[model samples]
Target: MIWQLDLIILVLVIVCAIAAINVKDLLSAAILLGAYSFLLCLLWAIMGAVDVAFTEATVGAGVSTVFCVSAVFHTTRRTTD
Candidate 1:
Protein backbone atom coordinates (compact mmCIF):
# COMPACT_ATOMS: atom_id res chain seq x y z
CA MET A 1 0.00 0.00 0.00
CA ILE A 2 1.15 3.52 -0.75
CA TRP A 3 1.71 5.27 2.53
CA GLN A 4 1.23 8.72 1.04
CA LEU A 5 -2.26 7.94 -0.26
CA ASP A 6 -3.16 6.38 3.05
CA LEU A 7 -2.02 9.49 4.88
CA ILE A 8 -4.02 11.72 2.59
CA ILE A 9 -7.20 9.72 3.06
CA LEU A 10 -6.66 9.63 6.80
CA VAL A 11 -6.33 13.41 6.88
CA LEU A 12 -9.55 13.75 4.89
CA VAL A 13 -11.35 11.44 7.30
CA ILE A 14 -10.27 13.54 10.25
CA VAL A 15 -11.31 16.73 8.52
CA CYS A 16 -14.69 15.30 7.63
CA ALA A 17 -15.31 14.07 11.15
CA ILE A 18 -14.49 17.49 12.59
CA ALA A 19 -16.50 19.31 9.94
CA ALA A 20 -19.54 17.12 10.53
CA ILE A 21 -19.46 17.93 14.20
CA ASN A 22 -19.08 21.66 13.66
CA VAL A 23 -21.47 22.12 10.76
CA LYS A 24 -24.70 23.89 11.68
CA ASP A 25 -26.86 22.54 8.87
CA LEU A 26 -28.13 19.05 9.51
CA LEU A 27 -28.10 18.11 5.82
CA SER A 28 -24.51 19.27 5.42
CA ALA A 29 -23.48 17.34 8.49
CA ALA A 30 -25.14 14.16 7.19
CA ILE A 31 -23.37 14.58 3.83
CA LEU A 32 -20.04 15.10 5.54
CA LEU A 33 -20.56 11.98 7.63
CA GLY A 34 -21.41 10.06 4.48
CA ALA A 35 -18.22 11.30 2.86
CA TYR A 36 -16.29 10.30 5.95
CA SER A 37 -17.75 6.80 5.81
CA PHE A 38 -16.95 6.46 2.12
CA LEU A 39 -13.36 7.51 2.76
CA LEU A 40 -13.12 4.85 5.47
CA CYS A 41 -14.49 2.33 3.00
CA LEU A 42 -11.74 3.35 0.59
CA LEU A 43 -9.10 2.84 3.26
CA TRP A 44 -10.49 -0.64 3.99
CA ALA A 45 -10.44 -1.53 0.31
CA ILE A 46 -6.89 -0.31 -0.07
CA MET A 47 -5.90 -2.48 2.88
CA GLY A 48 -7.42 -5.48 1.06
CA ALA A 49 -10.42 -5.78 3.34
CA VAL A 50 -13.00 -5.74 0.58
CA ASP A 51 -15.79 -7.25 2.64
CA VAL A 52 -15.49 -4.67 5.39
CA ALA A 53 -15.26 -1.87 2.86
CA PHE A 54 -18.41 -3.03 1.11
CA THR A 55 -20.30 -3.18 4.36
CA GLU A 56 -19.17 0.29 5.36
CA ALA A 57 -20.13 1.70 1.97
CA THR A 58 -23.57 0.13 2.05
CA VAL A 59 -24.55 0.50 5.68
CA GLY A 60 -22.53 3.43 7.00
CA ALA A 61 -22.48 5.66 3.95
CA GLY A 62 -25.67 4.49 2.28
CA VAL A 63 -28.27 3.62 4.89
CA SER A 64 -27.19 5.90 7.70
CA THR A 65 -26.84 8.97 5.49
CA VAL A 66 -30.26 8.34 3.98
CA PHE A 67 -31.79 7.88 7.40
CA CYS A 68 -30.32 11.15 8.66
CA VAL A 69 -31.51 13.09 5.64
CA SER A 70 -34.96 11.56 5.88
CA ALA A 71 -35.26 12.44 9.53
CA VAL A 72 -34.12 15.99 8.80
CA PHE A 73 -36.64 16.28 6.00
CA HIS A 74 -39.54 15.23 8.21
CA THR A 75 -38.68 17.72 10.96
CA THR A 76 -40.94 20.75 11.31
CA ARG A 77 -40.79 23.83 13.48
CA ARG A 78 -43.32 24.05 16.30
CA THR A 79 -45.63 27.06 16.59
CA THR A 80 -47.35 28.32 19.70
CA ASP A 81 -51.01 27.83 18.84
Candidate 2:
Protein backbone atom coordinates (compact mmCIF):
# COMPACT_ATOMS: atom_id res chain seq x y z
CA MET A 1 0.00 0.00 0.00
CA ILE A 2 2.68 2.44 1.02
CA TRP A 3 4.82 1.51 -1.96
CA GLN A 4 1.89 2.14 -4.27
CA LEU A 5 1.38 5.60 -2.82
CA ASP A 6 5.05 6.36 -3.28
CA LEU A 7 4.92 5.24 -6.87
CA ILE A 8 1.92 7.43 -7.55
CA ILE A 9 3.55 10.46 -6.02
CA LEU A 10 6.73 9.80 -7.96
CA VAL A 11 4.81 9.61 -11.20
CA LEU A 12 2.94 12.80 -10.36
CA VAL A 13 6.19 14.58 -9.62
CA ILE A 14 7.68 13.50 -12.92
CA VAL A 15 4.63 14.52 -14.90
CA CYS A 16 4.48 17.88 -13.18
CA ALA A 17 8.18 18.45 -13.84
CA ILE A 18 7.74 17.70 -17.51
CA ALA A 19 4.67 19.89 -17.73
CA ALA A 20 6.50 22.73 -15.99
CA ILE A 21 9.23 22.62 -18.59
CA ASN A 22 6.99 22.18 -21.61
CA VAL A 23 4.22 24.64 -20.79
CA LYS A 24 4.42 27.83 -22.83
CA ASP A 25 2.74 30.03 -20.22
CA LEU A 26 5.15 31.14 -17.52
CA LEU A 27 2.45 31.35 -14.87
CA SER A 28 1.25 27.84 -15.69
CA ALA A 29 4.79 26.56 -15.54
CA ALA A 30 5.31 28.14 -12.16
CA ILE A 31 2.11 26.57 -10.89
CA LEU A 32 3.16 23.21 -12.22
CA LEU A 33 6.52 23.59 -10.50
CA GLY A 34 4.70 24.19 -7.24
CA ALA A 35 2.65 21.05 -7.86
CA TYR A 36 5.83 19.14 -8.47
CA SER A 37 7.24 20.34 -5.19
CA PHE A 38 4.07 19.24 -3.44
CA LEU A 39 4.35 15.78 -4.98
CA LEU A 40 7.99 15.63 -3.92
CA CYS A 41 6.97 16.48 -0.38
CA LEU A 42 4.52 13.59 -0.46
CA LEU A 43 7.25 11.28 -1.67
CA TRP A 44 9.55 12.43 1.12
CA ALA A 45 6.85 11.86 3.70
CA ILE A 46 6.34 8.31 2.47
CA MET A 47 10.09 7.77 2.79
CA GLY A 48 9.90 8.61 6.51
CA ALA A 49 11.55 12.01 6.33
CA VAL A 50 8.79 14.09 7.88
CA ASP A 51 10.85 17.16 8.67
CA VAL A 52 12.39 17.35 5.23
CA ALA A 53 9.03 16.81 3.61
CA PHE A 54 7.50 19.60 5.67
CA THR A 55 10.26 21.96 4.71
CA GLU A 56 9.95 21.08 1.05
CA ALA A 57 6.20 21.50 1.12
CA THR A 58 6.40 24.89 2.76
CA VAL A 59 9.42 26.40 1.10
CA GLY A 60 9.37 24.70 -2.27
CA ALA A 61 5.63 24.74 -2.85
CA GLY A 62 4.84 27.99 -1.06
CA VAL A 63 7.68 30.47 -0.90
CA SER A 64 9.44 29.50 -4.11
CA THR A 65 6.24 29.38 -6.15
CA VAL A 66 5.19 32.77 -4.81
CA PHE A 67 8.51 34.27 -5.78
CA CYS A 68 8.37 32.72 -9.24
CA VAL A 69 4.82 33.90 -9.91
CA SER A 70 5.65 37.36 -8.66
CA ALA A 71 8.57 37.53 -11.05
CA VAL A 72 6.32 36.43 -13.88
CA PHE A 73 3.82 39.10 -12.93
CA HIS A 74 6.47 41.81 -13.02
CA THR A 75 7.90 40.73 -16.35
CA THR A 76 6.64 39.39 -19.70
CA ARG A 77 5.51 35.78 -19.78
CA ARG A 78 6.97 34.99 -23.19
CA THR A 79 10.43 33.49 -23.49
CA THR A 80 12.94 34.14 -26.26
CA ASP A 81 14.41 30.69 -26.23
- Pick by TM-score: which candidate is best? 2
Task: Residues 1-81, candidate 1: write the lDDT tens digits.
Answer: 778889999999999999988877877887999999999999999888999999999998999999988887898323222
Residues 1-81, model 2: lDDT tens digits = 399898878888889988899988898999999999988988888999999999998988999999999999999799743
Best by lDDT: 2
Error of 2 at 28 (Å): 0.3
Model 2 lDDT, residue 47, Cα: 92
TM-score of structure candidate 1: 0.89
Each prediction's TM-score versus the true structure? 0.89, 0.92
Show the lowest summed lDDT stretch of 10 residues, model 1.
72-81
Segments in model 1 whose C-alpha atoms lie over 4 Å from true places: 76-81
The Cα error of candidate 1 at residue 35, in Å, is: 0.5
Clashing pairs in 2: none
